[model samples]
Target: MARALDVKRLSLVRLALTSAVIVLALGGGRALAAEPERPASQPQPTPPVPAITRECQTPAGVKTAPIPLPNTLRALQQRKKIRILAIGGASTARSGPDRGGFQEVFERIIEGAIKGLDVEIVNRGVSGELVRDAKERLKVEVALTQPDMVLWQVGTSDALARVPAQEFETHVGDMVRWLRAHKVDVVLVGIQYTRSLAHDPSYQAIRRAVRRVAQREGVLRVGRYEATEALERVRQGRQPTPPDPFATTEGSYACVAQYLAQAVTLGLFARRVEPRRQRPPNPAPAPAPEMAPTPPRPLPLPPKGG
Candidate 1:
């Protein structure tokens, strides 16, 4: 009787399994395999921009002090143009990597930097001329061209000629004053610095004179010698600043031009002087006082005596 009971229980369990299988098949297996739906993924945030650091900067050193260019600035505003007269020292030649020397490169730079402003550069550089010669002809050039500014490359020739520092200083100072008085701005470009000449008393003296004049006159001074020397020192790391500013490339001019452009920008935005008001011509001197009364009185007295 116990063995019969066990077989009935096994048959009931098999019937339950068969019923579950039939139900799964009737549901087509799709519902049994289906999974819960998932939400879409969100996008990632954009990265922040890098701060402008000095590391990648080209190491452009501090520009020369701001020199006031009232006339130049006024001309730029009133005429939308400025004329530049470039006069060079005795050895200020037009030889450089680019066919155009500093003046040409300089002109291009100013025009490009300040949109809508035209620059007319007159290259009157007299190669091998002395400082005194340049000073003498400066007035003539001003009268002829009527430039808004004069870019004087004055010291190299004077230095080469062994001109007295006092004399050189005087010439430069005089010209600077005269130019300013005439409503023309002047920028002095110093002598070229080289290693061999670094220790030379004459060259160094001339360089000092140029500096003094620039400071005294309150005009822009392009430190060609000083800048080139510093740059070469940086380039040849661990090497003593060479007696030669350059190794093989004629690239000093390009660098000078770049520095000059920096200085020009500084000068342009410097203190804005109101355009000078023109004074009306004085009224013609009152007609010379008539002497007729005195003459008539003398004639009458002579007739009465007769």
Candidate 2:
């Protein structure tokens, strides 16, 4: 009876040990299968933007603070909502509900390019006002709206009024500087060359002067003459050129306005893509070292003199 009891007891112990080993083996297999895979070495992607440096210059060759686009304008474009106040010559001012001309065309183009974007373009163009007049009226007429971007289109009237280039430059520069000081983004649209002006040396000289001022001021140029020239090229190719002597007739003006609006939309896109500046990458924290348990230290040696 004792021998039989010993055999049964040994069998029970062996069974328990086998069951525990099988469970541990199954658990180990599951853990291995569930482990996540990792790549050998992950590479970080390069940033999409190029670093931009801001700088400004004065007519007297004095350098001033870097005058880059404002962060507020960039932020607004990113949000897909931009408020634009276009103040200039007749080209910009003719878009009112009552006028129903190039302005409507520009509005349609703007709406098309920036879908779902809240864009408002207010036109305040007086028939024959020069740069000084526009600047004088801006405070009461335009500043009240507090637009994010201002398209200054006054050089045409300035040239028509025979305003000297230097005076024009000073007035325009002051207006731009003031707007910048107040954190407004200004884009200067150079004057469109008329058929009469194209042949007139004096008018051409004024156009060149306007371009110089615009460049020195760091203002974006819409290149009205180039756009008109392109349209003229297209018109020339047509066997029967239209009766209109003006390259920027109602139809041509509509086309140019559409193109300009698209250009504005692209500018807005660029603002969104790059923003004010590229932010530096955050530094990674140093990894903690794995600390192995220290072995028991040997008993301290007997006191040095002992």
lDDT of 1 by residue, 1-306 (tens): 999999999999999999888988876456666845577876423222122123212366635887878888889878889999988843433344555566676777667777787999887877778888887788999999999999988787788789999998998898899999999998888887677778989989999999998887778998877777776665665455533333323455656776787678778776646779999999988988777654444444465557
Which pairs clash (backbone N, Cα, C closer than 3 Å) in model 1? 90-128, 90-129, 195-243
Query: Relative to the unseen true structure, what is the Cα RMSD of model 2?
Result: 20.6
Candidate 2 lDDT over 70-160, as tens digits, reads 5334645467577677777663444334364455667666666545656677877676778877777876755687777787665777776
Off by over 4 Å in 2: 1-72, 75-79, 91-101, 237-247, 271-306
Give the Cα error of residue 104 in candidate 1, in Å: 1.4
The residue ranges of model 1 lying beyond 4 angstroms of the native Cα positions read 1-62, 90-97, 237-250, 272-306
**Cα lDDT of all candidates, in order?**
0.75, 0.63
